[model samples]
Target: MKTYQTSHIRNIVLMGSSKSGKTTLAETMLYEGKVIDRRGTVEAKTTVSDNTEVEQMYQRSIYSTPLYTEFMDHKLNFVDTPGSDDFVGGMISAFRVASTCVMLVNAQHGVEVGTEIFGRHAADYKRPMIFGVNQLDAEKANWENTIDSLRQSFGKRVALVQFPVNPGVGFDSFVDVLMMKMYKFVDENGTREEYDIPAELMDQALELQASLMEVAAESEEALMEKYFDVGELTREEMIRGLYLGFQQGILNPVFCLSAKKDIGVKRLMEFIINVAPAPSARLEVLPDESTLECNADGPTVLFVYKTALEQHLGEVSYFKVMSGKLTEGQDLVNPETGAKERISAIYAVAGKKREKVSEMMAGDIGCTVKLKTVKTNQTLCAPGVEYVLQPIVFPQAKFRTAIKAVNEKDEEKLGDALNKYSAEDPTITVQYAKELKQTILCGQGEHHINILKWHLNNVHKIDVELYAPRISYRETITKVACADYRHKKQSGGAGQFGEVHLLIEPFVEGAPQNNRFKVDGKEMVLNIKGKEEYTMDWGGKLEFYNCIVGGSIDARFMPAILKGIMEKMEEGPLTGSYARDIRVYVYDGKMHPVDSNEISFKLASRNAFKEAFRNAGPKIMEPVYSVEIMVPSDNMGDVMSDLQNRRAMIEGMSSQKGFEILKARVPLAELYKYSTTLSSLTSGRATFTMEFLEYAQVPSDVQEKLLKAYQEEEKED
Candidate 1:
């Protein structure tokens, strides 16, 4: 390998839907660069990029694998990202680190969900994009139809940069519009060769060339004028303007290649090295609050986008150097924590292999070792720099399930395994529910958790169990009631005796953040906004200063009484549902001189809660999430109708690239299996991401059904 002074570096990430040939494409590129002796297929489980034990079994790229090749006098660092939506976090992380998105598509499938998934990301980041139609050598592959799908999915701006001379079984070469020449290759063993355009295809090639020039001319006002005046443009002018357009995201060039056969990869490599913008050429970001710009020579600031746990090898910290040169053995301040650490070692990562580099210049991607305190999304920069990149936000877990290891001994190991996995993948969060008493694992879908399980057992050698997560439903009262309780349990010589009376009502979000206690045993009405109030009697040792008129209740003993009432809330009234957000009014109560302990007051408070809950109407609250679903416009009616049946409230709808974007709020309970259902309904076209929203009351009938199910399950247990 050799280095060049006029060196060019391309930070590109290969992204697309599964089986779209992303991993195989990386394999082809490595083979083309002679990095590997033999190319590995996804079927044979020998690909370098998908080397993970789990990925090998599944035959997909489940993580981002960084691989680079020095070719065409340029160093291209390719971040091969996973195609499965389960690992979408990897895809997004790659996009944030890369300046270009090389979106791959299956020639036969055209623009499938995988292509569309990464396409949205490329558009969002405003990154330059190039489409590669892979598997062109596969039987019955149609290049033109794939281009049409791209046009339908993207727009008319999608132009052919290289045209395949022979497609499907006959695929052998491609015509480069820029060079105006044809290059041929035999995919049988992926041998490079040269070819002239077939005479019969010359006229079509000329027509495509005309379209290409027109697009290139439209890239700039001056070029447009030149083309209209002379009816033609020089090759230099076309190439220069087209490169500008692509760099500016004004044009998306479609290139052809068969990663399986490695045809057209040389041209693909050349385009990446020549067309992709250099590190300095791309934009550098700065905090909105700061005046300092991101400078390579300025104090170094690197954002750790991902971290890996390497068993006995400590940790591997992968970061994006936003500015300044970072060399091994140099110390820099952590802009986040203000702690300085000597750069231990710097290396370019490929799969699990690390290639030691003495230095990683500005805009270069690499990894370092043994950073104890750092994790994913942490900022590591010069001391006192006080700069931080925004956190890597992810969509709320749309699906959840109870996860328990098969053996009790694996319980702690399960937690440890999840912690390690979470360190690598920030999107997956595992939490223990105290009330549900289950280790709840939240993720994108069932397949998402399944992949984690695969990684856990095989990669980390830990077995785990999984089941549907328990629903966290809260119980509340509808009507207002008040009652008094007198505890007369005399197990001790002093005896346990206390009398308490209290009133309970619903609480709202705007209720005072401060908790106040008043001991005025008076009558107060429970009023829900925009609804009538139920006048109820207040009687208890507990007193609730629930936004009532002044002098309504006394202040003294109210705290103790409220504590008693709180004990009841912790236990619940009808079902032990941990009653949430309820106001308890303790008007008055008599304490036994010798027996009124906290236990007696608690018992008295419990009775009062039951009385109030019976008088006041009770309702159930379920969690809902704000969801935005992106689907093709044609599926709008079907989606809306299906959502309506699921009790989804559509906020609005909009059109995007032949797809309908639906914004709606739906209860979490109805969305557990939505991924599978949406796939079935749209035949795998609709995709959605959801975030936690406010809780809403469940309708009476639905609540009854849910309650019945819960009660039946309880009985079974």
Candidate 2:
């Protein structure tokens, strides 16, 4: 395939709720462009975008699949994204590369939850979007009702450029309200015929056409002046107004099409070329993002939306060239980490396949190879250009699950594969919990996490077992106490002798996590950040300024005592969790100047802290997460009751997308397994997301049980 410039490309992404006919719509677009002779139904899974076998079996898109078509002069590249909340990463990745998002709205369902999600994503990225109200031929599809629902659900800000002329059963095709003409189809057999507005629908069409013109006229001062002077907008004037309104987010042109029957499909294509904003007009993106205009001569740059790891072909970098042309083997530097790497190859992506290309110009969305240092959210620049293109700020992953290698033999391989996917997709986060000793994976929802495992198992040949993620609970002191330890050794030529005294006190509520350890003996010490490293919080003296006036403990031994205290804090006092916020005071202690070295004092201080914890009232604290479950309002009571059972405290909530957003603070321990439970209760329709909110004190009864359990488990070990 020959290299295409950015101006020749029309990167449109198909996004909407599950089963909203996005794949079919995309197939129709492909068929009209003559890219494919036979259009495969979603049931048959022969569609180009939904090519995965799993998608065929399930009959739904599980990931974003890029498919391209050359429509006359424009290279119409499209990505069909999954509608389910679990596969949100697919939407995020696809939206990043495309200049516009073709939101497919189900006339029957109106604005569903997933539609709201992609709409928010588009608004966040400031990407111009066009809503495609599809399936006009299906029963229960009322065009007027759908528009009302759109206004009620999405907002009245959406402007309709066309309305379905023939309702469902009488479904002939669509009427271009702005153009004041009707485009009808002869039948469902891909035959088309243009005619004057059907006599019966002309009256209603004129009213809507006028309303569209009025809305457009108000968007532009010139159009408003034209309307005032002539009392009507010229045909050219109206079209220009509509396009400009769309470019500025004022007009969300709504179009009608029945991809199943291929009716109105051709008109939609024409609109894409005519009314749809060009790559140069899709919300002028700034490389440095100071409200930039779409300029072709700006610095050559592309935002790496995603990185795909191919089993045999190796790593592929997919990006949208925002500015100047980026050719093969160019020196590209990452603005995020200041790491420089040379691009080895450039390939225009087409579905699961790719066409080798030597260069890609500005406004083009494509990929490259051998970019080890480049990553998602990183801007690739052509030196001295120094531009940080804005990256899509997506919602944080809330769903958590424990991951284990299916085959223990490939455990390390699984770890490596997960890191690659995590780096490739910013929405999915992978973390290793030291205390739980388990690798935890997080995503937008259960479906999101499941796709990761599927890819790992299928593409990487590494299977993984998934469970709930471990809650990172902590244990700290509630009261203050004092303790001391003395050690004496005379078994060898060099004997060991050391002594330590410490005051263990709880830091104020929500204290800073920093910890300080000081020396008051004859050893050197270090007070580190997370572990141990600092030698002082103050000027080095402890307790009374006169407590160690006579040098009861030599200053040389202070380092050893500090080191021991540092190790003890990381090892924890009661539950082996990291101890923070508490200050250790070595007020009075005796150390031998000659025999008491760091190791000798370390042994003494380690024991002293363990004894102090017993008296300091060290308590266990469990992590609690702020969870928001979006469910049909009908299930509000059920969700509330379920949260109550999980030891949760409700926060605040509101309604969105025919669902109620129920907010609650629940212990992470109980929520770790909520993914499977919530799915079963909501029949896989309800979605709940959670983030690590804060850690709180475990009730005495619960704390006692955990303490006993820990002791028993330790005994077994």
Candidate 3:
């Protein structure tokens, strides 16, 4: 294979909603470039982009598949990304490496939720976008509605470079306004012939061409001046103007496509090769806030955006050359890990097919196998150069559940499998929630987790169950109370005798410490000897005061007493939850000289704290999350109503681009499977994000139920 310069390399990503024909279009593009002899359909499970078995079973692209085609003496590398938001990680990773986005829109559905979501992502990343209206041959295809939807979503930026002539079934041709010619496809094999605009369609073609020229002219000062002087632009000048506008993100050109029939596939590739931004068009930002120019002469630097474990190949790490050239057998150091890795072999990837390439230049995308310590988002540079590239920031996981293997023996195996899956896809996160004593798995939505489960059940041969995760509730007291506990045990040789009288009170931030308290209608004052404050690991603080007057309790035993109280605080007495924000004053206690060991004092203090906590106004607190939801205006009311049923406190609501934005604070306990519910309510047209807000007290009824449930669990144990 030949090494292409940065100017000759075009990196693009195919993005759209599911069933938009992105994979089909990719197959057609590969066929048109002569990289493949025949086109493969998605239903046949033979498309290059959806090559994985899981993808074949689901008939959808789950992971981002990188493919390259040599077209017009240039290397065109594009990533086929999953359309479902459940697998948005793939799309986001592609966004980081690709400079241009080919956003496919299913003509039959017009602008869909996936289209809107992906469009927003492209805008956020500031990537140049070109719209491809695919599935033009579908029976329900509507070109006019699709165009209107595009205009509504993107405003005047929707520049029409091509429009389908006969959009429904039997669609075989389209008029290119920029070229001022009609391209007719005679067969399904992409055989095309250019003809002058027919008289019947001359007026419509001229009108669209004039609009296209004006949009292009606005992109450059020189082009605008020429257009104003001559009232028109030549073909070459128009192409230059369009290129500038597209690169600057000022205009998004629209093209027509019937990917299933190979119609307009060749034309789309040609336009991309002609107009898409070159690899060197913009400077790449580094992790240190520095920019690096794509130069084949500079020191070699490669950034790995993806890593996967193939069947035969141990591991394949895909990367883009950020600077200079990378040759096979070259040694580079991973700046983040400080580990050296030798690039043993390089291959141009076409899904499962890998073509050996001896060298790759800057801005070229390729893969290498058998790297010792290289992961996604890590950069490998020449020996002396320690430079790291900016990492892709993935969205926070919204759906969470506790996962456990059916057989206890496979627990470790299940953990290993989860780790591997998480490594391949960062969105799948796993963590052991110590408080809940359960291993929690979090991802974008239910479907995302189901896919991982499918892999575990089928591939790893691990049977697992997913259940609702327990909430990390907190325990606190509302009012002050007091109790005393005495622990006495007579054993052989030695005896245990200890009595504790402690005053419990709620701790409030910025509140003055109190040395006087009234308990049971009696006023009691304490002499403060020492006070210790500790910030609890969970949330609040524990304040302990030693007010033992006249050596009532030994100072040396204070730590042991505090330790006893700590155990109770960790496992709250109310519902075995973590207790926080309380003060304990050991005002008085009794200890035997021979039996007053740490164990005796610890046991005595533990019981004393538990009794006092129960006597006090014990309250259970649950975690609340601030949730923001985006849904269509028509479904806003239903979404809000559903949220209300989950005990959500609506914060705000607004409108944007035909969608309604709703904000609320909902308890995490109520958010179980909320993503699934929202999708069902809105017919999969709604999206949402959730974040931890603050812990708040649960209602009295909820507190009763939790207390009863905990009591039942304790009895069963």
Best by TM-score: 3
lDDT tens readout by residue for model 2, 337-453: 888988788876666667777877777777787887776777888788777776766667767789999779998898898888787677788878776899988877766787777
Error of 2 at 14 (Å): 1.6
Give candidate 2 misplaced runs (Cα > 4 Å): 1-8, 139-145, 165-170, 187-190, 225-231, 282-293, 328-345, 455-463, 490-494, 509-547, 592-595, 628-635, 653-664, 673-689
Q: Model 3: C-alpha RMSD to truth? A: 2.0
Per-residue error (Å), model 1, residue 322: 1.5
Give all candidates' CA lDDT scores. Answer: 0.74, 0.74, 0.92
Candidate 1: tens digits of C-alpha lDDT, residues 1-717: 332221366788898878888888888887776667788888999888988777887777778888876676666778888877777887677776678888898998898887887788788888999888888988978888898889987886697878888797878888877777788875556677766667887887788889889999988999999999999888888887788889889888888888877787778888888778776675555556443333467677777878877768778888877777777888777766667777788887666656787876667778898776776777777765766776666656756778888888878888988977777777788888877789888887668888888877887677787877776666676545566777788775778776666556566545552333322445444322112122212111222543323423233434555666666665555455566666665555666666767666667767766777766777777778898999877777888898998899999888877888999999887787788778778877788888878667799898788778777877998
Tens digits of per-residue lDDT, candidate 3, 474-527, equal 999987888888889887878888788898999999999898888878898888
Measured over all alpha carbons after superposition, the RMSD of each candidate to the real structure, in angstroms, is 5.1, 5.2, 2.0
lDDT of model 2 at position 62: 79
User: Candidate 2: lDDT over CA atoms?
Assistant: 0.74
TM of each candidate vs. truth:
0.89, 0.87, 0.96
What is candidate 3's TM-score against the reference? Answer: 0.96
